[model samples]
Target: MSAGKGLFVSFEGIDGSGKSTQARLLAEALRADGREVVLTREPGGSPGAEEIRALVLQGDPERWSAETELLLFTAARRDHLERTIQPALACGATVICDRFADSTRMYQGLSRGDLRRAVDTLHDLMIGVEPDLTILIDMDPAAALSRAKARATAEERFEDFGIGLQEKMRAGFLALAEEFATRFAVIDGNRAPEAVAEDVLAALKARA
Candidate 1:
């Protein structure tokens, strides 16, 4: 870890678990505190990564196999790190990412199959960057799905995995968080947005 490096914080959850909102609030709060902040999301940050993110979330992913999807995510992460995250961190700008390596591990590694192998492969293949902190906005899978459906946005292939599978994905994320307790903050996402934002701010304050 670079002691002089910018703080690397990741916000993770199912599609409608309020992660993005919390990340935004936290970024704004960090800025208000006179800290430089870079707020970005995974699967996309730079132009090229945005294209890849679109491919992963909005396209006919049936064109690609599960193995292919995992590899592509890792590729996107590598570019994101090399081109965006690394430089910002080197300059000491705290980076608050909407999602990061853990998302892939939950969506693909645990939900899909071969969890252990996927973790190993991604670590070996990517630049091996992990977040300094990961906040998991925890909520019931059914509630999260309902919120997601209300948004009426284009669904990612992962979101279409059905409620049953999504429940498993939730469990997967929780288990993964458990494995890295020191780096995780599991907050109740079912709460009001302002309350949730406060929770996120508290976590950031603790870390900061």
Candidate 2:
């Protein structure tokens, strides 16, 4: 919503809820309509951020304490904003991010209730940017965990937390959407990808 700047859209949901796929589909659809779009993801977008991504996502999930993880994520986000996101928006390109600050809020804050204030405070002070629109792909945790497990990757630290954590994450995301209704579009992600993509497009058009 920056003055005359391009649209900023972010996808958020529990792992394997297909938010990443939906974000890509939306970007493709926008480009088909002749809109300039930039597709990116958090924890890694710019060069410096990607390096940080490796540090945070690889190895043991307990490699960093909750506070340390938050700091790393914040640092990466700052770098991404400075090097990638801001530049794209300045040039009037719709930037579609796979995840944003909402993920940090849900993962870090909801995981430990007391940390919510810290996350918001750090965000306000260091990373004040918020997406113009955030698409939350809601899905059952069991299904999402299945989908997430099917994809084998070295960066499985987040997924390693297992089903219980994913269920908590789903609830956290839903609560967040309700809290920020004006900027959120909640989409059912239990259906087929094509169907979900159609719904996502419809929601974006409605907002537009």
Candidate 2 lDDT (Cα, 0 to 1): 0.91
10 residues in a row with least lDDT, candidate 1 = 59-68
TM-score of each: 0.93, 0.97
Clashes of 1: 0
> Which candidate's TM-score is highest?
2
**What is the C-alpha lDDT profile of model 1 across 1-208, one tens digit per residue?**
4323889999999878889889998898889989999999988987778878887887563656667778877888888888889999999999999998888887777777676576667666665678888999998889888888788777556667669877887888899889989889999998898999898888877865
* Model 2: ten consecutive residues of lowest lDDT: 106-115
Q: Which stretches of candidate 1 lie over 4 Å from their true place?
A: 2-4
Q: Which residue pairs in model 1 clash with each other?
A: none
Per residue, candidate 2 scores C-alpha lDDT tens digits across 21-99 of: 9999998999999999999999899999999999998888788888888999999999999999999999999999999
Candidate 1 has an lDDT of 0.83
RMSD of each: 1.7, 1.1
Please state the error at residue 140 of candidate 1 in Å: 1.2
